[model samples]
Each structure stands twice: as structure tokens, then as C-alpha cells.
Target: MSNIGSNPLIHFAAGATSATIACVSCQPMDLIKTRLQQSKQTKDAEKYSSVAQAARTIIQEDGITGLWRGSTSNVMRVVPGAGLYFLMLQMANRRYRARTGHAMTPLHALLTGSFARAATAVIANPAAVAKSRMESVGVWEYKNGRSAVIDVLKTSYTRGAMIQVLGDVIYSGISFAMVNTTSPFAQKKASPTSQFIVSAVAGAVGTAAAYPLDVVRTRVALSKAQGKDAGIVAVVREMLEEEGIAPLYRGVEFVALRRAITTAVTWSSYRAITAAVGRARR
Candidate 1:
């Protein structure tokens, strides 16, 4: 087990694999969540009515595929985020353990995880923004909307991916820190099932913390979809003025659920994979 801790490549592979699996597993819910978030109750109070009702309507109208509308982009965004998040976390944990000559405490785990997640988010933010925009409602309805993905890449290049990347770093850094910090505390006295509950709570906290930035990113990305250029502040202001603060956190509950499921799957799969790898090595 300790030897496995030293193998960076193995850890990276495990993290990437686990993240991919987690993303694929929860993609449908993620799509639904995004749609719900994008819905404007002010524009049409009857649009979705409720998240549960929205889910049912999407499933009925678009079938299973509707629930996974932007799955490809979602997977792309998640793979790197998850992979790097865990890789950084494991590496951080190893260093922390070596320094203290103790197994990772829950607090340590939280800090390491948060740091890793933040780092990954920096690298993966543009793609994440693009994915969120692609998953947004009106963006795809326009005839030129099909080009939104390409436009996102082009706009990102023009604006410098660095800016978007930095935003992601800050957003993920704070969000992960909060979640990771609290998660271990929750898990400390929990049973196995209770640990899952703790993780879910952590995920929800993280999502809520980062959601405002997510809204800004989505709007920025969607602006390109509409053949416009707008920075994060501009987009946020537009949303606030046009839709109110609620629009900034459109699908918060869904985001929470998505994060919770993703966190649970990520940790569970990571543990399983690490164990399997350790067994195989032995």
C-alpha cells in the first residue's frame, strides 16, 4: 500500500479512470441539472415548474439521450479534472504522511484533495465552461448554435485561456477547500454508508460555494454561442440585471446532487482501484 503511494503514474491512471467512470455514471443527472439551472422562472414561471418535474419531462420528451445531451463534453471536462485532482491529492497526501510519519488524517485528506481539485480546475476550466454553455438551453436552439463549441475554442484562444483557467483555479480552490475540509470531519465518526452521506454533503457544499463562478463561466461561454464577446463580470452583471441573483445559481440543487454523486463515486472507485492495484502488485 505504501509502495503504491509512491507510484505517481499509477495514481494518475487510477484518478483518471475513476473520474471517467464517475462522470459517465452521473451524466444524465448532470444534464438535467444544467437544464434546470438554465431555466428562467422570471421569463416563464411554468418552464420547468420543479426540478423533479423537469427531469420527468426531459426523460419523456427527449428520452434517455436528452438527459445526457452534453455527455461528451461533460466526460471531457470531468476526466482531466478528476484525474489531476486525485493525482495531486495522492501526491500531497504522501508528502504529508512522510512529514508527519502518520497515516493521513481526515483533515489532511481534505486539504490535499482541495488543493488537487483546485489545480486540476485551473487546467480544465475553459473546457468546463464550454461544456456548461453547450449544455445550456437557448444556446443550442439557434441554427448557428451548433458552432458554439467551436466558437468557445476560438473565443478562449482569443481571450487567452489563461483568464478562464485562473477563474477556475480560484473557484475550484475555494470550493474544494470548503468541501474537503468539512468532508473529513463528517466522515470521522461515520460508518461506511455514513461516509457516503458525508461525502455527499461535502459535494453539495463545494458546488454551492463555486456555483456563482460557474454561472459566470456558463454565460461567458454562451455569449460566444450567441456570437457575442463578454467577460465574466459582464456576463454576471447581465444575468443579475436581466434575471436576478437567482439566475446565477439556476440549478444549484441539481449541481449539489451532481457533485454529491460524483464525489461518492470518485472516492469509492478510487479506494476500490487502489486496493485492486495494491493486490495485483503484491
Candidate 2:
């Protein structure tokens, strides 16, 4: 059983596969959330007052495919990020149990989850930056995922680049870990029937708490496209000065709703993968 967990390949596979499943299922909501964020920041935000307005506006203005805009970049980041996140989280849980003679507590979840993401943040941040930029409405005119990647990479040489990209990833990790830990099945103790409900609640809570950071992440990703420096502090300062705090929570309602379902799907799939891997070794 321990052997399966030790295999880096298994962790990667589990993370990527589960993330892909979750991303595909909740993509439309993600798209709408992006639109809402962009609208709030822009001068013409009044055109869309609700989630339905955002969706309809995207369909009407950018076509139906616009609703899935930036999905490629989203998958690109989420697959690897989710994979790394789960692998680290699982490893942390194992280590925690070994050290404490019991399962992880909220404190353990908070610390381990933060550490896992911080460790993976360097690799994951660039992808996150790209995903958010691609998702925003009035940002860049990225022709495709490759172009967006190339464009973002062009700015990597700037000072404080790491801090800029990592700020939100760190916040996201802490939020997800803390909320996900609350799952009734987080200790992997729930019966099959109850896993969904428990995991769903956990996912929703974490997603909602972490949403403000997501909004900041998206705006920071767009900084370069808007002809500004791509530092987290600088962008944040500018946002506060120009747009105010309200912009940071622009799409919270839709994001929380969508991610609740996505998180449930992701976490549940992760458990199934872990179970299968463990059973295979047995």
C-alpha cells in the first residue's frame, strides 16, 4: 500500500485525471465567472447584472464557444496543478498520520495544504497566470493557448515575477486544503454512498473562501495584457486604487456555485484513484 503512494507516476496520473474530469464538468461556470470578473473591472460592466446575463452576453457577443473560452489553458494548468496538489496532499496526510497516530486535523490540513501548494507553486503559477488571462473578457486577444503561453513567458524576466505568480496559488492551496479537509470522507472513512455529499460540501466551502484570491489572480494575470507590470503587489495596489475592493469579489457567487460541484467531482475521483491504486498493489 505504501509502495503505491511512493510512486510519483501514480500521484501524477491521479491528479491529472481527476482534474481533467472536474474541469470538463464545470467549464461553463468557469467561463461565466471570468466574464463577470472582467465586466466588473471594465467601464461597461452594467450590461450584465447576473450570471444569466453574463452567459447570455458571452453567447451573444463572442458566440457559444466563447462560453468555453480559455478552457484549453484552464485544462493545461489544472491537470498538472491538481495532480501535484493531490499527490502532495496525500503524502502530507500519510506523514501526518505516521507522526500523530491519528488522522489529519484542521490545523494539519491548513499547514500541509499550504506547504504542498507552496512547493508546487513555482511550476503551477505560470499556468494559472495564463489560464486567468485567457479567461478574462477585455484582456488579451490570445489566438490560442500556445500564443498565450508564449506571450506570458515573454514577461518572465521581470523582477518579482515569482511573487506575482505565486501569491494567489498560495492562497488557493490553503483555502482548498482547509475546506477539503472538512469532508466527511477526508479521512477516507466514509461509505461509498456518503462520499459525494461530504466531499461536495467540503469543495464548496473551500472554493467560496478562496474566491477573492482567484479574482485577484485573474486581474494580476491581466496586468501584462493591459500594459502594466505583472507583479502581484503592484497589480493589487493598482486594482485597489483604480477599481476598489469590490472588483476582487466580482464573480464570487457563480464561482462558488460552479466550484462546489467541480471540487466534489475532483476530490471524489481522487479517492477512487487512490483506492484503485491501493487495491492493485494488494
Candidate 3:
């Protein structure tokens, strides 16, 4: 029960357009989340404390622009990835209905969203790598999005780099799947308010559960870029021993906040956009 338009082209355009706007609003939260994840300090110094503290630090150190670090690379995949995600999930729903002659159940939504997001994540992995690396406070020093991609590609063609890329993609895929599978309830509701609230809540739940993987992915990706590949197991093992599980969940609440805002805005905007386009087509 998705509200995305029947036309694939419209659906794609709606998703891309909506996501771009949402990204701008949500980027600051994302920046703090990334810093929290990439952070390596310990004890009291390790604390970001809250969103306000993290923002002030980033602004004081890197200026306001720092809050949007790596946004170019992020936008690169975000638009198309959003487009592909919605389109594929919708297609999956169609197939499910045709085959079973029933609406998408919660289980169906989970499975379809997971598979669809996994596909989008694989295709968008390079962008993910670039964003995470450039977002890390003092990691790779790519000039911009294009340079970031080229620089990563130089190393990413290697087996080690590819492994790191796959790990990041898988992490993103699962996290997003968990967030989006809750789309059914949101979409089922016709009101924009209900949709926003439900989607936002769904996003928060997913981010809380899957955020640790995001930290691991960022670390592994950066390590690989520096020609020091760290497998997921090693990354998790070392982080656990060195910092414990708490570190893994750092900045998670902020991520949940960002996810809620982004999901609410993106889906509401998407529904509005597609509806407008549909009306114009008449």
C-alpha cells in the first residue's frame, strides 16, 4: 500500500526531489552523527554530550561548513538511491500482490524493503564510501565529491577495498530496510500528519537498532582507504575490546532524531509531489 505513483519515472523523480530537500534539513544532524561515530577520544574527552555540544565543537573547529562536510558525496547517491529504493520497493509490492493476491503484510514489507534497499546500497556503495570517509573528522582529504570518488576508486578496485565497500553497503542496506519496512503503516494512512509521525517513528526504531553497524562501516571504510583494510569482524572486535558497546552506539540518539525528521519530510514531500504531478497529468 504505497502512495508512490504508478509511473516509474514519476516515482523516481518524486523520491529524488523529495530526498534532496530533506537532506539539506537533516545534514547537520548527520554531520554530528558521523563525528560521534568517527570519534576516538576516551573517558570524559570522549563525550559529545549532546547535539548542541557536537555542533558547537564542529562549528568552532571546522566552521559552519564543517556541519555539511561530505554532503556532496552524500547527495550524489541520496537522490538516485532514494529514487531506486522507492521504485524497487513499489515493484516488489506489485509482484507480491500479483502472486499472492493480497496486500503487503508487515513481513512482506520487511522482506521486500530489505531486498530492494540492499540492491540500492550495492549500486550506491562508492558514494557511501566517499561520504563516510570525507565525513570522518580527519580522515581522507579529498577536495570534493568528484575527487573523493576518484581517490576511493583508485584503491577501491582492489579486493580489500571491495570488501570494505561491500561491508558498508550491507550495513546501510539492513539499516534502511529496518527503517523503511515500517512504511506500510505510514502509507496505509492517507493523512500527511499520520504518515509523517508513523514514518518518523519507524525510522527512529530502525536507526536505534542498526546504528552500531554504521560506526563499524565508517571505520572499516576509512581503514581500507588508508591501505589498512579491516574486516567487519576485526573492526567490531577491536572496537568492542577498546571502547566497549557504548562506543558503538555513540551519536545514535542524534541519528534517530535525524532519521525521524528526514523520513517524515521525505515521505510527506514525496506523497505531495507525486500527487501534484498526478493531478497535472490529468
Candidate 4:
């Protein structure tokens, strides 16, 4: 059988499917993270002091469904974002192998993952901004995903996208590098459980390292949505002035948890799907 990663269609399908499953399953965590990050900037600054408090407030105010408020927007962005990222990764790795006759080194994996994530962030930023707006407290007038996108399109969304791209590139690069350096998945004999565990650990490490940028990205998007200054510098300045360094890591625990779960699911599902396709082809 042909190598599964040789086919762009398989890569996209596996990536998109894995993203969808991860997004749907872990959306509540995302929502809570967004809410926590935005809470400090909102009028009700004390509304969500912690994860449990945020979750309780969401359930009480908007029902349990509120925990997934931005899920559609998130899925819209992440599905295609993940697909393109994996496709880019496959193409990059193939080219590297063709030229070097060696598997990607960790450094090469880092560069490839950074490029893929930055490209995806640029393309998917509007949807990401919409997702943040939808998830934040207040500014809940969006009737559907389309309306949210339209609203974001009408605003100054590019700065937030730029900030997001920076964070994502770092996070993706580090996570991919860590996986290549530490994971057992390179061995044909490696079990799926080991792969999953490795991916999760790598993701948690990456998330911890780059998580402050994530908070800034969310705040920038929310600021723009609220017609405030959303420039990266401006958002950082405001955050520092108002809440100091602590606010930048407000929801790190939740995001690290979410990233671990999402990365584990994505990689595991992608491997399973591609393996299944390879088997079927044979």
C-alpha cells in the first residue's frame, strides 16, 4: 500500500476529523478559559475568580449549554486550521526527507510546526476572534456563527490574529519538537496508549511555556470586539497596568489541561484513522 501520509486527502481528513472530535469534546474547557481571561477586563471583574466559579456562573446564567457557547465558531476555525496544519506538516516532512534522506530532526519539526501553525492562524483568525467574542461575558448578541464572523470582519481583528499567530507558532513548534524528541511513536512497535501519553505531556509543556500569549490573544480579540484598543502592545500594556503579570496567566491551568486533552485526542485519532485507511487500502 502507498504510504498514508503521501496522500493529502488522507492527511486533511484525519486532521479535520481529529480536530472536530477534540473541539467538540473539550469545548467547555475552552469556554471557561476564555471567560476567565476576559473576566478581568470585563465590568464584573470578580465574576469568575476560578475555574469552578466560572463554570458555575456560566451554568447559572446561560445554563449548561453556555459552557459551549463558542463551540461552533471554534469548530469552524479549528477543523480547517488543523487540516491545513497537518497537510503542511506532511508536505514539509516529505520535502525534508527527500532532500536529507533522514527523518525530521526536532529542530526541523519545530520550524515546520511553527510555519504550519502561523499559516493556519492567519487564515483562521477571523473565526477565532468570533469564537472569543462569543465566549466572553457580555457581547452575546450573535444569533449564529455567521453573524459573529460578520461582526468580526467589520472590526479591527488583524492585531489579535497577529498576536495569536505568535503564540500558536511558539506553542506548536515547541509541542511538535517535544513530541519528536520524546515520543515513542517513531517506533513501529509503540502502542497507541504511549503515543497518547507522550502527546499529552508534550502539549502540557508547550501550553505552560506559551500560555501568557494565549491570554493576551484572547484579551486583544475581546478588546477589539468591544471597540477598544486591540493592538498587541496596547493590550499588553493595559493588562500589565491593570492586573500586572498575574492576569496574563489567569487561566493557564485550564488551557494546559485542554491542550493536553486536545493534543492527545488529535494525534491518537489521526494515527488511528490513517492506519485504518492504510489497512483498507491493502
Who wins the TM-score comparison?
Answer: 4
- Model 1 over residues 212-239: C-alpha lDDT tens digits? 7665655565565446687766766777
Winning candidate number (lDDT): 4
> For all the candidates, what are their Cα RMSDs to the real structure?
4.2, 3.3, 3.6, 2.0
Candidate 2 regions off by >4 Å?
1-5, 40-44, 156-193, 224-226, 230-234, 241-243, 280-282
Clashing pairs in 4: none
- Kindly give the number of clashing pairs for every candidate: 2, 1, 0, 0
* Candidate 3 per-residue C-alpha lDDT over 1-282 given as tens digits, one digit per residue, 9 for 90 to 100: 344446788888888889888987788788777667765632333435666877888888888888888889889868888898778866776777889997666656666666676677766777778887777654467789879877767766332244434443443344445445555555566567877887687667766766666777777776653446777788778778987888777777778888878877887888788878867877
TM-scores of all predicted structures: 0.78, 0.82, 0.85, 0.94
lDDT by residue for model 2 over 1-282, one digit each (tens)?
Answer: 123657777877888898899897787788777667664455556756678887788888888887778778778777777788778876777777789887677666767766776766666666666767777766567888667767667865333335534553455555555555555443456465466666566556666666666666666556655566656777678778887898777767677678767867876787788788889888
Compare candidates 2 and 3 on lDDT and give the better one.
3
CA lDDT, every model vs. true structure: 0.64, 0.68, 0.70, 0.83
Screening candidate 3 with a backbone cut-off below 3 angstroms (N, C-alpha, C), the clashing residue pairs are: none
Error of 4 at 85 (Å): 0.4
Task: At residue 69, give the lDDT of candidate 4.
Answer: 88
